[model samples]
Target chain A: MMGQTAPMREAAKHAILILGALIVIIPFYVMVSYSLKSPREIESNTGGFFGAQAPMVDEYCVKVGNPKEDCLETPVIFNYSQAIKKAPLFRYLLNGVIVTASIFLLQVLIALPCAYALSKLRFWGREFVFSLVMFCLLIPVHAIALPIYIMLAKIGLTNTYASLVIPWTISVFGIFLMRQFFMTVPDDLIDAARMDGMSEFSIVWKVMLPTAIPALLAFAIFSVVAHWNDYFWPRIVITGDRDLYTPPLGLREFQGDADGSMWGPMMATATIIVTPLLVVFMLAQRRFIEGITLTGMK
Target chain B: MAVSSKNTGFWFVAPAVSLMFLLLIAPVLVAAFLSFTDYSLGNQGFSWVGLENYIKMFSRSTYSKMISASVTYVLLVVPLSIGLGLGAALLINSVRHFGDFYKTIYFLPVMAALLAMAIVWEFTLHPTIGLVNETLADGCGAWTETVFSFGWIPGIDGGQSWYSKGCQDSFPLWFGDKSYSMGTVAFIGIWQAFGFNMVLYLAGLTSVPRELYQAAEMDGAYRAWDRFRLVTWPMLGPTTVFVVTITTIRSFQVFDTVEAITHGGPSKSTYVMMYAIYEKGIQQNLMGIGSAITLVFLVFVLLLTLVQRYFVERKVHYA
Candidate 1:
């Protein structure tokens, strides 16, 4: 009897989970499907999920006074090509890469040494510095946007890449995470490097960094995913500068000027903006989960 | 092996210390100092206005809306996301097959760019010709309309059935309706957030020992729920606290959805604090009021986190 009921219980669990999975995937389904469909099909909600792969005339192409025949193309081709061309999307994506990369690199360059110092070295005022990091952890960057923006404006730095990357460069969370990680590095490894005439800096780079790769990888994933998806800060600082737009800002810009006919390319843009991280996440599910949930680590 | 002569630690930490001071600490101080003044970017010199901004914040209806909207969002999203996350984690934990598959599917929301997904959800939730309305219209003929309707109960009439009513009339203009705007934004926030919480809870669940279950079973906890109560609940105490604190903080910081989708629309029902700060400070350049909101936001976060730390230190030190 118990054995019989076990399958039923499993089936019940499957039922609930399947419902949730459907809700979650509905947007992704719409995103990918709309990216493939023509605007007419999207507006009419017809032609099925994959659409008919029908030849659709590019209205914008004709609006630009191209020959009507020259404008005729498949919806898929039009959607993706226009997605790239409608804005400097490639530039936006490249800027996304540049900003996220520079921020992570600077965070590491500042944080690793500081974290190592806090965790490994016996120094006066070390406790004070660590306490400061703990206190700064409470200050979410978004909350203090007013003063930060004012300060940046005073320095003549708004609408610049430095504005996008500078405030986040000092991530106390990274400092804290790395310090916690560094504390676990066996003392003997550092002592051995010291005995071999390695300076503390050299030991930090040569010994501790290599040992902390997993933790560092986790931090890297955390930082990259965050800044890549961050819209609030970029939206504030990158105003009027299309060249400095991140993916989210680029998408927002596309939407702000868009007409009804732009849905296909707009979704294609959305998919393009969202795909890189999504694909990476799907591929490295365990690592991504571990990285994100690293906060839960004691 | 003692090399205290150079104090290399000072050199290593100085840059980070100074940057932290400038970026993090100074902003809080600046916001507090500027909150009492009419400081704008171009104006340079400004006159002090003691308690004026705070008075406006308390007196203004718009600020009240902001406070209510933010509190409502946090109250709703925080609990619901944590509940769903814990539920999903528990369900996935007990399942023998396709656990990783469910996990991958659920975690997709967390991984996707929220702004992009919000746009997609905006499309799907579009009032006309969107997937939600279309799907609801499809359900008009099917038993789905009947099953969901509570009209079968004698006291509840067909008019009382939201599902049937929606099927009869049009479904809601979800993000456009004031009554539904904050709820809809909160829903999107939940959709994005619970996945992260689920992943965290999954990690926490894995750390729970098998021996505890055996011990509970030996203690006459024969039923699944019994063992869960006797073992799992106590074991998960720490995870629960951490999840609650982290989710609360993240929910407090919710801006992308409200900014992109609602813009505090449908009568400012979604005027969250972050958006308020952005609108007042960045867009309109009201540095005084903006800094006031920012200081309040900072204090709320600081107090909440301090409370969380106190709880961690004094309250939930589990076995």
Candidate 2:
């Protein structure tokens, strides 16, 4: 009886979880499938998962005075091509990489030293600075975006890439994450580096960095995933500048232009914007989960 | 060459400290000050409007709707997502196989961009051609409709049921209809957020000692529910506190979905706080009113976190 009930319980749990999994995966399925189908298929909701691979005419291309034959292409090609061409999705992808990479690099640059100072080296006002960081952690940057935008506008920096990156450079959370990580490092390691006549800066980069790779890698994933998907700050600052649009913002531009007929291209744009992070997450699932849940450590 | 390590510490932290002051602290102060005045971006000089924006916020119907919408969304998303998250974690923890597969699938939404997902949801909830409606349409005159609409009960009017109504007429526009808009948006919020909470709870679950469960079992906790109540629930207290606080805060900042899909619309049903701030402050350039909303938002957040801290100190923390 116990063995029978155990299998039954396991089966029930699996059933519930599979249902949840299906609901969770529905949007992704729709996103990828619609991106593969034609406008007619998308509107009327025909075609299977990979679509029929049927040829479709680019109505806009023919409208631009191109021959109908020249405009003819497969649904998948048309969707993806229109996604790239209609919007600067490639440029948006580049901007996403640039912004996320710069934000992460600048965060590490500013945070590692401060984290070391807060955790390892003792100095005057250290407690005050740490308390300040604690207080600032309570300040969600999104909540105070208006004033920051105003400040950026006053400095004539709105719509530049700097506006997108500057406000994020001071990641109090990064300092907190690294500081927590640095607390685990042995004091003897820093002492040995000091005895070897390495400068404090060099010790931070060369000594502390190598050991903090796991924590840093986790933080890197967290930061990149965040700023890459971040739409609000970019939306607020990068108004009117197509060149500075991030992936999310670019997807939004596609959404704005989406008539009922534009679903394929829009979904294609969404797939383009959402794919990189999802791919990375799949490749490094454990690290990605750890990075995302890094906040739970507090 | 001769600089002391003690002094080097300040130099190391100086950049971060100043930037923190400049970026985080100063903006908050600016917001607080600006909330009391009629300030715009390019205006020369403006007079202080003492509590005018706040007055309008409290008295006006639109701002009241904004408050209700935000509060409703927070109230809806936080507990539901956290509940779903804890449930998933418990089930996965109890199961022997395929736990990793479920965890990965659940966490996929957290990985994808919210704006993109929101847009996809817009399509999925489209009135005529959406997957959700299409799937429901396929269920017309079937057991699904009968069972779901409660036609099985004697004397119950299944034809007047929501499922039947949807089958007869077109289904409600999930985003376009005001009644369904907030729920649909909150559903997306829960979809995106629960996986994050699930992962957090999974971490918390792994740390609960095996001995405690054994002790409970040894003490004659024969049923699974009994064991869970005595051991698991108490063990997950700290994680619950943290998860609730974080989820509440994130729910308050739900901009991407509202801004992308609903535009705080179908009569402001999804007019969440973050979207309100963006619309009032950035788009309309009504700096004073926007700053006023920002201040109100910061106050709610700070109060919530303070309460969470109080709870953690008083009750939740076991270690």
Candidate 3:
């Protein structure tokens, strides 16, 4: 009876989990399917997974007085093309890359050295600095976004990439994460580097950095994914500047301009905005998961 | 050597410490001070309005609605997401096959940008053309209706069922209806957040000792339920605490979906605190009110984290 019931229980669990998996996958399925669909198919909610590849008239092209033959394009091509061409989708994606990359790079540049100092060097005020970090961790920057925005506006940095990137440059979480990681490195390693006449700066860059790659990679993933998806900060800072708009901001703008007719291109824009990270995540699933869950260490 | 090390440490930490003061610490102080005054950007002078903002926050109907919306959202998202996360984690842990597959599927939402997912969800939940209602519409007068209507229970009315009602008329305008808007936003929050919690719980589960289950069984907790209650639940206490706190904090910070999809709603049903801050502070230039909200938000977060720290220190450390 126990053996029989156990298998039945396992099957039930699997069935329930599969239902959850389906629910979770539905939007993604809708996103991709809608992106591949024509406006008519989208409105009517027809077209299977890939949508009918039937050529559709480009209303915009026709409005621009293009010939019917010139305006006709397949659903996938039309959706993707309009997604890129309708707005600066590529530019938004590029801004996303630039911002997330700069944020991560600056965070490491500022945080790695501080982490090393906090972990390895014996110094006065070390405890004070660590506790300061602990305190800063509690102050979620989003909560204080008003003051930050006002500061940026006062400094005439609003609507610039600097405003979007400046506030995030100091990641207390990154400093703490790297500090914890650096503590695990053997003291003999640093001492050996010191014996070879390596400057502390070089020791940090050359010796410690090599050993901290795994932790640094995880932090990079965390930072990149975060700033890439970040909307609130960008929305606060990048008012009236389309060029500085990150992916989420860009997608929001697309949604803002959308009529009922624009859902296909809008979804296409969403897919474009969202796909890169999802692709990177798929490629490095374990690392991405580790990077995300690294926050739970707090 | 020691002096050189000390000097290097100071130099190394100098930039980060100063940035921290400028970026993180200063903004918080600015918000705190500004919360007590009638200050707006570009204003030459301001008057001290001690506790006026807070007083208004406590008394105003809009502010009360904001507080209620935020509290409702946090209450809905945190518990439901944590429960679903723990459930998924436990199920995935117990399953002999395809565990990683389920985990990967579940975590996909976490990896996707929330704003983008929220937009996609908006489309998915569209009342007329949406995939969800369309799918439900397709199931009208079918077995799905039969099972969902609860008509088989002998006392329930089949024609009055939500499914049958939806089929007969239009489905609820998920984000358009004030009644369902907050729940829809919270659902999206749960959809995006639970995966992260699941990953954390999965990690916690791995750290639990296999021998504990055997030990519990030996102690007459023979059934899986008994063993789980005696062993698994107790062992997951720290994780439960951590997950609860983190999920609570994240739920509080839910801005993307609310802003992008509902725009604080069909009424103000989805007017979360973050949205309120954005609206009053930035858009309306009411820095004082925004700062008050910010300060309130910061205090709540600090208090919660402090509580978590106390609990972590006082309990859940079996080792």
Candidate 4:
């Protein structure tokens, strides 16, 4: 009787799990399917799996309405090319890469030493500085936007990538994350390195860093995803220059213009923008989850 | 070794500390100072007007609306997302097979760029061609021809055209109408953030001892409510605090979604304090007023954080 009950319970649990999984996956399935559908089919609501019929690719290509005659109707043929041509996609992508990479590099440079000092070094005001760093995390970025904008404007840095990347490079959150990871490193290793006549910087570089690669990679993923997805700061800073538009801004541009509403191209742009982050997260799934869990635990 | 260690530490920390001081601390101080002035972007100089900006902000009708909208959004999104997250975590925890697959699927939203996702959601929520409405129609048989009568049930043509040949006829613009925009925004916000909170809850749930649940079961606490109350709720206290605190702070700082989806309006319906600050300072060049609003928002968040810390620390049961 107990064995039978256990099986029944386990089956019930599996049923619940399957239902929950469907709720999460269905939206994503719809998104991907919509992305593949022709514009007319999307408009006519005929492309749905249970609908009248699956609209063919030709219907969507014509609806995509690329001015360039090079666009053709074939299986898997869509007007993504026209969408790319309409905007400075490569330039936006370049800016995103430059800004995201620059910010991540700078953050690591700044956070590593600070984290090491907080974790390993005993200083006069160590606790106070550490507390202040944590306090910084509580202060919402919105609170500083106005003043930062004004200050950046004063320094003639408004509308420049520096305005976006420079202020963002110094993240207290990253320091805190790195500090937590650094705390796990054995003090004996540091002591041995010091006894070998290695400088503190060298100890950090050779000893702490090699051991903290997972933590750093975790933080890198966090930083990269955060900045790449960011629309607010970039929107404020990168004005008047279409060339400076990030993928987010570029997609917004596609929507706001007189083309009415190009669902096909917009979906295409969205797909392009989201794919890289998806790939990165999948590739580093374990590390990403670990990083997130560690940060949340704090 | 000790002597060199101190010097190296100082040298190493100098760059980060200096940058933090300049970028984060200095601007906050400047913002505090600017709040008291009547500075505008057009003016080369400004005279101090103590409490004037604050007074003006309080007196304005629109400011109150913005505040209410933001508050409503935070109140709804934070709790709902956290609840959904905990539910997802609990369900996922029950299943041993395909656990990683389930986790990955749920986490997709968090990994996807928000800006891009917001655009996609905008498409998904479109009245006519959107998959949302289509799903409702086919799955539930719900339809409405009129905006006012578009109930959840399908097949009722209330004489509303969801999409017109022109751009003018899209019914119930989610971000345009003041009455419903905040709710719409909150719904999307919850969807976007539910995954992050779920992961956190999953981690917390993992640490809970199974023996407690087994004991409860042996004691005949087999009812759903009894099991959850006796076993799950107590163990989730720390995670609850963390998730709620972070979600509240994040909700208060909502700008990217508003910027991407609404631009703060069909009529400033979605304009939270942060977006207002950005608009006034960055767009309109009203530096002083913008700074004042920023300060006000800062104080509000700080006070809330203190309250949360007080309650959370008191209630947290650390194992």
In terms of DockQ, the best-performing candidate is 3
Clashes of each: 0, 0, 0, 11
The lDDT values for all models are 0.89, 0.91, 0.91, 0.76
lDDT tens digits by residue: candidate 3, A120-154: 99988999999999999888888889998988988
- Please compute and give the TM-score of the first chain of candidate 2 against the native first chain: 0.97
Q: Write model 4 residue lDDT over A1-298, tens digit each, in one string.
A: 6778777887787777667667665556655655566666667767464223333334334568854344344312343654676687888888899999999998888888889999999766678778879888877665687777777777899777788788888889889988988998988989998879887777777898899998887778777888898888778877888877887888778778725235665666677787888897899898888777776667
Model 1 interface RMSD, one decimal: 1.2
The DockQ figures for the candidates are 0.79, 0.78, 0.85, 0.56
Query: Which pairs clash inside model 3?
Result: none
Off by more than 4 A, model 1:
A296-298
Taking candidate 2, what TM-score does its chain B reach relative to the real chain B?
0.97
Candidate 2, residues A270-289, lDDT tens digits: the string is 99889888898989898888
Clashing pairs in 1: none
Contacts from the true interface found in each model, as a fraction, amount to 0.80, 0.88, 0.90, 0.71
Question: Candidate 4 - CAPRI tier?
Answer: medium
Judged by whole-model lDDT over C-alpha atoms, candidate 3 comes out at 0.91
Scored against the true structure, residue A295 in model 3 reaches a CA lDDT of 58
TM-score of each: 0.98, 0.98, 0.98, 0.88
Models, CA RMSD each? 1.4, 1.4, 1.2, 4.9
Report the C-alpha lDDT of model 1 over B106-223, residue by residue, as the tens digit: 9999888899989889999999978989888888868877777876778888666888878877799999999899898999999988988898888888888898889888889999
Superior candidate under DockQ, 1 versus 3: 3
Candidates sorted on DockQ, descending: 3, 1, 2, 4
